[model samples]
Target: MPDDKTALVISAHSADFVWRGGGAIALHRAMGYAVTVVCLSYGERGESAKLWKQDGMTLEKVKTARRTEAENAAAELGVTDIRFFDVGDYPLDLGPDTRDRMVDVIREVQPRWMMTHSKWDPYNTDHMNTMRFTLDCRMVAQAWGHNPGQKVLGAPQLYLFEPHQTEQMGWTPDVFLDITEVWDRKWAAIQCMQGQEHLWSYYRNVAENRANHLRRNSGGQAGGRAAKYAEGFQTVFPRTVDALE
Candidate 1:
């Protein structure tokens, strides 16, 4: 096993991590993993509909509000580090500069595992694009020629979190994490995303449903673990294990 107990989460929007991977973040933190979150954009333009409805709302003000909410949510999840790229949303600027920055962060963190959005999300191309961008950065970070003096990153498992419309996204989860113990922390983090109140209940329902999946997959009624809340993930790479237990 790797000596460093660290994990990274790359989120397209500020509040995306809270809704999608908050439970994992909290649970990992509780297990002594330092979880770092990177928010590529504030989601000010596209996702802050509730804030936009209020009077005197400018782009900067909206971004600030979203940032605050993200920070508060990260605190609730016990995140070790939270970074904001501040790159524009709607169509994220996943240019060479941003790619280099991400690669640098990947090298610096040297995470044991990583998490991001699903591979496909037609409704929100930003979500899909972020996953691609993450893959690109991960590859570059592992290239020895990219940055000679810097330490090359080792292969880390990239887990794709459940999307909003799973049916449309073509995402199939192979891993179900039981977050029952950290449900309260995840719920508190979810509440911090005040700008997107509409999604609060929807994600709660998703967690409950995933918990049922966890129980069924573990063994159904005979000897299944009763999980009250859970999160699902589809891994991009095959996991190497020594034993099949």
Candidate 2:
């Protein structure tokens, strides 16, 4: 971790951060890192069976419910800011300007670490595109580090969070965060996304699975890995090796 750093997450949909990396966000916040979330879409097309259970809920009503849920989830994780791009929700489309816009945001934030979806997630097309596009923007932004007129930024550590289909997505973890202390808060964060009925049980199971991973890695250490819960990440470009790599 960098000194007094800010951590940012660019999620493909509003519910992604809560479902996948909520513990990581909570851990960062507990450690005093300023956390921000950039949700590429409002996730209107996402699962909303729970929220839609009410009588005669229109699309506008669903949108309102999801927005509130996302806001509440961020608050639970102690996030400082959450920005929604309101981009189309079905699947993330990184056309052309999306990449540039993400680059600009990265330069502005210049965070010490960034988290987002993995590139091979088949569960959601938008997540894969978000992963691909964000990585693309990350490289382009770093390449222009010294160029005049571009926001200056030393490349930040990038971590890929699990997608909806971790097993199917071929997610391999190389980093684990023991979010034991903030596990309750992580649960609280995920519970905020009440719109996604399909997620509640699934994410809780994911949490337990990752917790087991931590336990195995820690060799039953008191707290280091034996912690009851955690989040795992697969990193790209682990360290800066050259001016241009």
lDDT of 1 by residue, 1-245 (tens): 23489899999999999989999999999999988899999999999999999999899999999999999999999985999999999999999999999999999889999999999999999999999999999999999999799999999999999999899999999999999999999999999999999999999999999999999999999888899999999999998999997
Which candidate number maximizes lDDT?
1
Worst 10 residues of 2 by lDDT: 144-153
What are the runs in model 1 whose C-alpha is more than 4 Å off?
1-3
TM-score of 1: 0.98
Q: Clashing pairs in model 1?
A: none
Residue pairs clashing in model 2 are 92-126
TM-scores of the models, in the order given: 0.98, 0.88
What are the per-residue Cα lDDT tens digits for candidate 2 across 1-245?
34347877999888888888899898888878888899888777656667667898887888788889899999999986898887777766687778778877787777889999896966677888888888888887787543458766677788998776677988898887788788888788888887776678887887788888888877755654566777888998767576862
What is the overall TM-score of model 2 with all chains considered together?
Answer: 0.88
Angstrom error of the Cα, residue 175, model 2: value is 1.2
Clashes of each: 0, 1
lDDT of 2 at 227: 69
lDDT of every model, 2 decimals: 0.95, 0.81
Query: For all the candidates, what are their Cα RMSDs to the real structure?
Result: 1.3, 3.9
Residue 93 of model 2 has an lDDT of 65
